[model samples]
Target: MRPVASVSFDDLLRAHQGMIRAFLRRLCRNDALADDLAQDAFLIAHQRLGDLRDTGAAKSWLFQIAYNVYAGHARKHARRRELFEAQNGADLDDAAQPAPAGMARDIAMAMDQLPADVRACVLMCLSYGMSHSEASKASGLPLGTVKSHIKRGTEKLRAFLHAYQQA
Candidate 1:
């Protein structure tokens, strides 16, 4: 693996940043988060550019790095979600504040009703814009399981929201 020259690395980063960010956004569904991951991926690639011998493979190399970043972020989110559940997320903050009297609070309250796995799948697939396969990969579930979770979760959310609106 030969190190990419600084000048070449600069050009590579410029040319590929948008593409990497777009790919990450498809997986993450959050533009800000996707952009952050893209920056991290580029930084890592710059640090490891010397280890890569094939400049022609730059695009693939950068994408591989981006995937690694996304996977790592998924694992971290899972851990945090577990910790939040264990500690009771409400006890941390959402509980301490008086519930805002509005749709936001209603939605949040409704979201709290969802089972953790279902919620995770919904956020990843529907809210975040991840494809079903990508959500399955991130959630470490079977493809069928991911699909099932999303289907059931959305139905529940729909019902919950409808009830809230009626109230």
Candidate 2:
């Protein structure tokens, strides 16, 4: 990987855009929002390109930015959802919404049950094939915390899937 100062924005975007979008889609389970957030992430990356010190770590750095974007959106959405529910005297649970008809509802629900940090760590490591160190960097979590999250997250996923299989 070339240094950040040497790499073109187009090249970085071309290399990472799809993976970033896919990761966001899995996190949010919303295609449009994921696409929008992916764009937002790229924009942020472009602005911060000068800050990148090690080009070899670009992927983890990009994931970090993307994860931050998703986290910010999740926080904003949760607050708005809470206020809306309070005003309407109603409760709404995003996670309780059924998966798309043909999707694996059990897996989706299980993943949704994870806290955001845990899910992000698990997905970064398992879904994206990132190393533990990379996942740690991407999630901005300590290395041990990232490993612990992956262990706990996978356990929950396995138990959930096993129960689903039995039913």
Least accurate 10 contiguous residues by lDDT in model 1: 89-98
Q: How many clashes would you count in candidate 1?
A: 4
Question: Which segments of model 2 are wrong by more than 4 Å?
Answer: 1-6, 85-98, 101-103
The global Cα lDDT (0 to 1) of model 1 is: 0.71
Q: After superposition, how far is residue 61 of candidate 1 from its true place, in Å?
A: 0.3
Estimate TM-scores for all models. 0.47, 0.82
lDDT of 1 by residue, 49-140 (tens): 77667665566566668877977887778767578878775322232234546787777666657765676677666764677877666557
Off by more than 4 A, model 1: 1-7, 82-167
Question: Per-residue lDDT for 17-91 in model 2, tens only?
Answer: 989988888787677778899999999999998888888788889999999999889888898768978988653
Alpha carbon deviation, residue 81, candidate 1 (Å): 4.0
Per TM-score, the best of the predicted structures is: 2
Predicted structure 1, TM vs. truth? 0.47
Q: Count the backbone clashes (under 3 Å) in each candidate.
A: 4, 0
